[model samples]
Structure formats: structure tokens, C-alpha cells
Target: MRLSELANPSRFNALAERLLPWLVVATVLAFALGLYQALFVAPDDYQQGATVKIMFIHVPSAWLGMLGWALMAVAALGTLVWRHPLADVAMKTAAPIGAAFTLICLVTGSLWGRPTWGTYWVWDARLTSVLILFLMYLGVIALWRTVEDPSRAARAAAILTLVGAVNLPIIKFSVDWWNTLHQPASVLRLGGSTIYPTILTPLLITAIAFTLLFVTLHLMAMRNEILRRRVRTLRLMRAAAANP
Candidate 1:
């Protein structure tokens, strides 16, 4: 089906219902296999030792933190430009999930950094930008709640999202932009990945699992939002009938 077609709430809900089950199954299975490989199969780093194992979770969380915002940006565009039916739902539902992932990324990075960098936290560019990203997620959620009308809230949040998106590139390139404690991009380099194949395999698997989990959660959240809107509409209608 076309993007325009899916913009209808009924069509969107129907598609979500059919896909949700398969998403859940895929998410669970991928996470299981990914965890197994990351814990047992992937080789430990020579320098970081066992502490490097945190990469399995940390890297993926960071990826999702950025990816969630990127997805929200697209949804925001849809709301402002196309006024897609599911756009606001996607944008609002993504905030908490993105915030959670950003929190995980920060905590795990701190844990991994302690042994590697001899510090738990720093004012490094990469770390600071990611912190800002987390704050932006909170800001978006706050905007959504503070505004009473859904349409106004969505438009305000959409504008904020677009403005905050400037940080995404800074977060990605901060290590290169400044001399920081954080390591530069090794796996996603221009030439090729520097990581060993053994370690890379598990990292890839775990990342996929995390991505699937994010999608599943987003879909579920959207579904709930739709139901909540229905309930609100019904209550408003009943109130109007009672008065008239």
C-alpha cells in the first residue's frame, strides 16, 4: 500500500494489528539469540577485558537513542506537512522510548568508561551532546503534556523536534570534531570496520534485536494511543448529547 493510503487511521490500525504479533515474535527471538552470542560467543577485548562486554548493550542503546529521534523527525514532518493520521501518534509514543534508550546509553557508557577512561563521566563533546539529546526528548514529552489540545501540542512538538535535530550530527561526529575521551567511529568508518569479525558479529546481531524491540514497542504504544483517542472522542460525544 502507498504512504497516503496508510495515513487513514482505520487502515493504519488494521495494519498494526496484523503486524504486531509478528513483531513481538521477531523481537523476542532476536533478543534471545543476540544475547547468547554477545555473552558467550563474542571475544573479549584485549585492553578493556570483560568490561568491553557492555558494548553489546551500550552501543545498541546509543544507536536507538539517535534512531528514535530520527524517526520522530520524520513523523514530525508528516504532521506538519502531510498531516498524516499516524504521525502525531508516532511522535508522542517515541519520546519515552527514546528517553529510556538515551538513559541506558549514558549509564552503560559510564560503566564502560570508568575502567577504560579511569572516569565515570566527563564534559566530553560526544557525551555532552548525547546528554542534550536526552534532555530534548524530555522537552518534547513535556511539550506534549503541557498543551491541552492534541493538534496544537503536535505542531509545537514538531517544531521543537526539527530544531533539536541539529544535535544528531554533532552527536555522531563529536569524537572527530574534538579531542575527546570517547573513541572515534570504528565500526562505521569510511574505509571499513576496525572491529574483529567475531566481536562484530554479535554487535550486529544485538543491534538488530534492539531495533526490532524498538519497532515492536512503538507499534504497541501507537495502538494504545489510538484507543485512548477513541475513548476521549466517545466521552466528548456523550457529554454533548447529554447537554443537547
Candidate 2:
């Protein structure tokens, strides 16, 4: 099928419904296995001891924070360029989830920082950029709500999302572009991972779990938004017919 045909809300909804159940089951299984391995199977770090266990959750949340925004940006591009019907729903649904993950990342980073950095917060490059990303998410959501016209709001939000995408690269490269308190990339660098298999495996699994969770939640929220719009349109049509 062509891209435009596939972008129909009903088609998207059908596909989402079919896939959601399987995704939910996989998310649960992956999370259970990941948590078990992270907490029980993974060996404690020689330096951080039990505190290193936080990495499984914290790192994944951080990864999703960036990933979610990237998804939103792509949706925004589709909305603007292709005029894809489902693109607005995709961007709208993704905002709150991205914001939540960003909050989790910040909170968990603070928890991890206290034991390692001797401080709960720092104005480091990576940390600061992530904070900005959280703010951008909030801004987009608020803008979406403030506008009365749905199409206008979606376009405005799309513009904001596209503009905010400039922050994604900054957030990704902050650890490398500047010397900071936060450690450099381990898994994503040119060289091999610095982490041992014991810790790396659970972290990878948790990252997958978190990604699946985000996708599942985004689809559910999009369905809700579509239903809301349908109801509004029906009400408007009824009012028009009654007046006529």
C-alpha cells in the first residue's frame, strides 16, 4: 500500500489493536526477566556495589527519552510534509510518554549521582541537555492543549517538535562534545563496551522492555485521542442537522 493509504487512522488503529496485545505480553516478559537478571543475577560493581544496579533502569529511561523525541520529530515531519492523518496523533500521544521517561531519567540519575558523584545534581552538559529535552516536551504538550482548533494545534505542535529536534543531537553528543562529570559512552562508542556481560545483558534487555512499553502506551493514547475527535465531530454534525 501507498504511504498515504497506510496513514489512515482506522487502518493504523486496526494494526495497533492487532499488535498491542503481543507487544504488551512481550513487554511484561522482557521486564520480568530483565529485572530478575539485573537485581539477582548481575554481579555488583567493584566500585559502586549495589548502586550500580540502578543502571538497568536509568540508562534505558535515558535512551528512551531521546528515542521518543526522535519518533515525535519524524511524526511531525510526516504531518507537515505528507499530511499524514495519523501523524498528529502519533506526536500528541508521544509527548506525555517522552516527558515521563525524561523525568524518570532525571530522578534516577540523581539517585545514581548521589552515591557516585557525591552530589545529587550537577550542571554537566549531558545532564543539562536532558533537562532541556524534558522542558521541550512539556512545551509541546502545553501548546497542543492551548489551541482550540485541532488542525492548527497539530501544525503548531509539529513546528515546535521539529524545532526542538535540534536538541536531540546535542543531548546525544554532550558526553563526547564536552568534558563532564557524567561518564562517556560505553555501549555506543567506536570501541567495544566497557561493561561486563553480567551487567550489559540485563541493561540491554531492560532497554528493549522500555522501548516496547513506550510503543504500547503511545498506541493506546492515540486510540483515545482518535475516539475523542470522532465524538466531537459527531456532536458537531448533530448540532448542524438539528439547526437545519
Candidate 3:
């Protein structure tokens, strides 16, 4: 179907429902394979040993945290610039999910660090920037809740989302731009991946699984948002009729 067709809430809802079952199957299969590889097939790190297993989870969470925001940023543009009906829904639904993933990333990163860096927490540039991202997600959620009018809330949140997007680049490049306890990029970089193929393969598979999981969750949230708005509209209508 054409992209514009999804601007219609009903069409979007129908499409989401149709795709959800397939997506769920794909997500489950991907997770099964990824986890099996991560747990049984991949060898432990020479240095970090079994602790390196954390990377399978931590890396995916970190990636999805960033991806959720990036998706929000695009939806924000749709809300403010194009005034697409579903854009706000997309933007709003993404915030809480994104925040959850960001929290996971931070917690796992800290756990990984404790064994490696001999500390649970450090105010490294990369870590600080990701924290800021999580906070921004909270701010956007609060902003939406504070405004009663849907249009007004969408506009306000859109601007906030765009402004918060500045943090994305900062989070990505913080390790490169400053001296930090965090290690440099080992997966995606200028000189290809530094990680060995055996480990890299599972990590990549896990990343794909996490990505599919995110998409499935995001689509489900959007569907819920559409139903919620309809219910809200009906309630307002009934209340107005009773009062009038």
C-alpha cells in the first residue's frame, strides 16, 4: 500500500492488525535463534569471559533506545510539518518504550562496567549523554500529558522531540569526542568491525531480533493509541450531549 494511505487511521489500524501476527512470529523465531547462538554457540570473551554475554543484550538495547528516538524525531516532523493524523500517536507511543529501552541500556551498561571498569557507575560522556536521552523521553511524555488539546500537545511535543534530537549525535560521538572510561566503537566503525566473526555473528543476529521486537511493540502501541482516541472522543461527545 502507498504511504499516504496509512494517514487514514482505519487503514493504519487494519494494516497493523494484519501485520502483527506475522511480526510476532518473526520476532519469536528471531529471538529463539539469537538467544541460542548468544548463549550456547558463541565462545566467551578472552578478556571479559562470560561477562561479555551482556553485550548481546546491552548492545541491542542501546541501539533500540536510539532508534526509538530517531523514529520519534521523524514522526515529530510529520506532526509539525505535515500535520499527519497518526504522527502524534507515533510520537507519543514511542516515548515510554524508548525510555524503557534507554533505562535497560544504562542498567546493563553499568552492570557490564562493574566487572570491567571496577565500578557500577561513572560520569563518562557517553553514559551522561544517554542519561540525558532518557530524561528527554520523560520530558516529552510529561509534555503530552500536561496539554489537554490533542493538537496543541502534538505541536508542543513535536518541537521538544526535534530539539531533543540534538542529543542523538552527542550520544553517538561522545566516546570519540572525549576521553572516557567507555571504550571506543567495536561494532560499526570506519575500519569495519573489530569484533571477531564468531562473536559478531550472534551480536548481529541479536540486534536484528531486538529491532524486530521494537517494531512489533511500536505497532501495537500505535494501534492502542488510535482506539484510545476514539474512545476519548466518544466520551466527550456523550458528556456534551448530556450537559447540553
Candidate 4:
């Protein structure tokens, strides 16, 4: 089905229902295989040894962390420009998930850095930018709650999202822009990835799993948002009927 068709809440719910089960199955299988390759099958890094295993989770979480915000920014444009029916819902539901991934990225990065850098934290540009991105996600969620009216809240949140998008490129280019302890892009670069196929394979698989997981959660959240709106409307109608 076309995405435009799914703009209708009923159609969206129907499509989500059909897709959710398959998504769940595929996500589970991908994760299982990805984990197997990351842990047991893939050879340990000659330098980092077992500590390199964390890369499987860390890289994917970090990728999702950035991707979630970009998705929200797109949704924000839809709300501010075309006023797409599902745009606000997409933006709102994405906040918590993005925050979660950002949190994971920070925590895993710290863990990886502890052994490699011999420290738990640093004020490096890349790390700091990612931290700011996490804060931005939380800020958006708070902004949504602070306003009571749906339209007003959506507009406020959309504005904030667009403004926060400036941080994305900063996060991406921070390493190059500053002399940070964090390493430069290895997987995504102008000269192509520097990672060996052995490590790259599991990372790619896990990244796919993470993306599927995000899609599944986003669809479920949107369905719930639709139901909540229906309930609110019903309650208002019942109250009006009783008073009239």
C-alpha cells in the first residue's frame, strides 16, 4: 500500500497490523544472526580484543540516534509546510525512541572508551555533540507536554525540531572540525569504509535489525496515538450529550 493511503488513521492502523507481525519476526531473526556474528563468529579485533564486540551495538545505536532525529525533522517540515495528517504523530512518537537510542549510544560509547581511552568520559566534540542531541530529544518531548492544545503543541515542537536540526551536521562533522579524541568516520567516508568485511558484516546486519525495530515501534506508537485521540473525542461527545 502507498504511504499516502496510510495517512488516513484507519488505513494506517490496518497497514500497521499487517506489517507489525512480519517486522517483529524479521527483527528477531536479524538480531539473533547479528549477535551470533558479532560475538562468536567474528574474530576479535587484534588491538581491542573482546572490547571490540561493543561496536556492534554502539555503532547501530548511534546510527539510529542520528537517524531518528533526521526522521523527526522531516516530519516537522511536513507539519509546518504541507500539514501532513500523520506528521505530528510521527514526530511525537519518535522522541522517546530517539532519546533511548541516544542514551544507549552515550552509555556504550563510554564503556568502549573506558578500555580504549582509559577514561569513562571526555568533552570531545563528537561526544559533546551527541550529548546535545540527546538533550534535544528530551527537550522536544518536554515542549510537547508543556502545551495543552494539540495544534499549538505540534507547532511548537515542530519549530524546535527544525531548529535542533542544525546540530546534526555538527555532530557528523565534529571530529573533522575539532581535534577530538573520538575517531573519524570509518564506516561512512568519502573514500568508502575502512572496516574489514568480517566486522562490517555484523555491523550492517545489526544496523538493519535496529532500523526494523525502530519502524515497528514507531508504527505501534502511532496506532496508539490514534486510539487515544478517538477516546478523547468520544469522551467529549458523551459529556456534551449529557449536558445538552
Candidate 5:
């Protein structure tokens, strides 16, 4: 089916109905396994000790924060270019989730930093860029809420999202391009991941769990938006009939 076809509310509703149950089950299972491995199975870091355990949640949340914003940017593009009905909904729904993940990442990173890095906050390149990214998400969401008309709101939000896309690259490359306290990439580094399998496995599983959780919540939010629009339309139609 075409992308537009998939944007249909009924189609989306049916798909959500079928998929939500399985998604929930899988998310629970993955989260359980990931937590077990992260907390129990994996060995402590030789240097950071128990503080490295935060990586299992913090890294996945940080990754998802960026990934969610990227997805919002793509949805914004689709809404502006193709006028896909669901794209605006997707973008709007994604903002809060992305913001939440970013907040979690920052908080957990601070907690992890206090024990390891001696300070909770830094003006490092990577840290600064991620903060900018979090602000961008807030800006888009605020713009959408401030606009009165639906189309106008969507267009405004899309423009803002596009403009904010610059920060994504900066966040990704900041560690490499600048002298930062944040360690350079290990899992995403050249050659291969430097992390051992035990630690890597739990991290990967937690990442997958975070991804699935995003999908599930995004779909739910989109469904709610669709129903909200439907209610508005119905109310307008009823008012028109009464006036006519």
C-alpha cells in the first residue's frame, strides 16, 4: 500500500489493534531480559565499577532521544511535502516522547557522572549539542500548541522541526570533532565495538526495548489524535446542520 493509504485512520486503528498486544508482550519480555542482564549477568566495569551499570538505561535513552527527533523530522518532511494525513500526527505525538527520553538521558548521565567524572554538569561539546536538541523538541511542541488552526500549526511545526535538524548532526559528531570529557564512540567506533559481549548484549537488548516502546507509545498517541480530529469534525457537522 502507498504511504498515504497507510495514513488512513481506520487502517491505522486496525493495525494498532492487532499489533499493540504483541508489542506490549514483546516489550515486557525484552525489558525483563535486558534488566536482568544489565543488573545481574554483566560484570562491573574495571574502572567505573557499579556506575557503569547506568549505561544500560542511559545509553539506550540517549540513542532513542536522537532517533525520535530524527523520526519527527522525517514525519515533518512528509507532512510538508506530501501532505500525508498521519505525518503531522506522528510528529506531534513524537515530541513529548523524545523530550522525555532526552530528559531521562540527561538526568541519568548526571547521576552517572557524579561518581565517575566528579561533576554533574559540563559544557562539553556533546552535552551542549544534546541540550540544544532537547530545546528544539520543546520549541516544536510549543509552536504546534500556540497555533490555532490545524494546518497552520502543522506547517509551522514542520518548519521548526526542519530548521532544528542541524542539531542532530552536531550531537552525533560533537564527541569526535571536539575535545570533550565524554568518551568517544565505542559501540559505533571504527573496526568494531570495543565492548565485551556480556555488556554489549544487554545494551543492545535495552536499545531494542526502548525502540519498541517508542513505537507503541507513538502509535497510541497518533490514534488519540485521529479520534480527536474525528470528534471535532463530527461536532462541526452537527453545528452546520443545526444552523442550516
Candidate 6:
């Protein structure tokens, strides 16, 4: 398919239909393998013991929480700068999904922390930044819902999404910049990963599974949005005809 075809709603819908099944299969298989490895194969952390298993879910949730917003930033640029037709759709669909993952990260992090940090919550820079990110996502989603016109809502949400993106970098570096309780990057760094190979392998696999799940859900959501807009357009046309 041509690059421009990606911008066409009907074309995207067709492509998504074909891709969704494969993506679903891949997501399920990856999750199966990842869970097996994380649960049964990978040994517990020497310190955290059984609680270490939470890392499999928490780490992926954290990564995707950031990734979802980063994706919206790119889609926002497409909306404001390039005026791509599917840009707003992509941005809109990703919000709830991202929010969900961020929520998972927070909940799982808190669960992991109670045992590890001796507390369920904290006001550290990293944690606060993530909370802000989650709120920004809700703000963008609310902006879209309040605006009656799709084009206007797209533009408004696009701007908010871009502005909120600054938080992403802050979240990544907060631990290093301050004396935060959160740990810095371990799996990815200037040097090699600090995590044990057995643990790292499952983490990577689970991350892939979550990412695949995101792509599958995002594509499905976009397809639904396209159809919804079509219905709205048709209804507007019908009302205009009746009034005339």
C-alpha cells in the first residue's frame, strides 16, 4: 500500500480488518509465552522473592504508559502540521488505552511498593509526573468529547497533547535528576542491562505482548471511529435534506 493510503479512512479500515486477526493471534501467543516464563521459569529476585513477579506486568505497563503518549505526540503533529486525516483518530483512540496502562502501572507499582517501599504512595517527582501524565490524558479526552465538531476537537486536543508531551522526558529522568525513590532505567541504558538474563528475557517478551495488544486495540478503535464519523456525516446530511 502507498504511504498516502494510510491517510485514507476507508483504506485504513480495510487494512485494519486484515491485520487485526493476525495481531490478535500474535498478542495471545506472546502473552502465553511471556506469562509462562515470568511466572514459572524466571526465578524470583534474590531480594524481593515472589513479589518480583509483579515486575513482569508493572514494567510493561510503565513503558506503554509513556509510549502511548509519545504516539499521541506524533499523531498530534500529524494533525496540526501535516493535517493527516487519520491523525486525530489515532490520537483519540490512544488516550483511553494509554490511561488504562498508566493506571495499571500506578496500581501495580503501588502493589509492588507496599512490599518493597514500605508505602503505597509517595510524592516523589517520578510518581507525580506520571500522575500528571494520566491527568493530561483525561483532559485531552474530555476536550474531544465537549467539542461538537470533529475538526475543531481534533485541533484543540492536538495542541493539548503536544503541550503535555513535555512531561514524558521529565518522567524518564526524574529519578536521576532528583533524590526520588523510583529507580532509574535498568533494562535500557548506556551500558548493558542490570537485570538478570532470565528475568530480562521474560520482561522483554511481556513487553512485546503488551505492545502487540496495544496495536491491535488501537487499530480496532480507529476503525470504529471511522465508521462513527461516517454515521455522523450521514445523519447531518439527512437532517439538512429534511430541513430544505
Clashing pairs in 6: none
Residues 1-244 of candidate 1: C-alpha lDDT, one tens digit per residue: 9988987777888999999999999999999999999998888899888887899999999999999999999999999998888899999999999999999999999999999999999999999999999999999999999997888999999999999999999999999999999999988889999999999999999999999999999988998888888888999999999999
lDDT of 2: 0.92
The residue pairs that clash in candidate 2, if any, are none
lDDT of 6 at 95: 96
lDDT (Cα) of model 4: 0.93
Instruction: Candidate 4: list runs displaced more than 4 Å.
Output: none
* lDDT values, one for every candidate: 0.93, 0.92, 0.94, 0.93, 0.90, 0.94
Ten-residue region with minimum lDDT total, candidate 5: 1-10
Cα lDDT tens digits for candidate 3, 3-87: 8999999999999999999999999999999999999999999999999999999999999999999999999999998989999
What's the residue-level lDDT of 131 in candidate 5?
87
Compare candidates 5 and 6 on TM-score and give the better one. 6
Tell me the tens digit of each residue's lDDT in model 5 across 93-174. Answer: 9999999999999999989989999999999999989988888888888888898677889999988888888888898889
TM-score of each: 0.98, 0.96, 0.98, 0.97, 0.96, 0.99
Error of 3 at 133 (Å): 0.6
Score residue 65 of candidate 3 by CA lDDT. 97
Q: Model 1 segments beyond 4 Å from truth?
A: none
lDDT of candidate 4 over 1-244, digit per residue (tens): 7778878988888888999999999999999999999998889899999899999999999999999999999999989998988999999999999999999999999999999999989998999999999999999999988997778899999999999999999999999999998889999899999999999999999999999999889989989988987887899999999999
Lowest summed lDDT window (length 10), candidate 2: 1-10
Q: After superposition, how far is residue 154 of candidate 4 from its true place, in Å?
A: 0.6
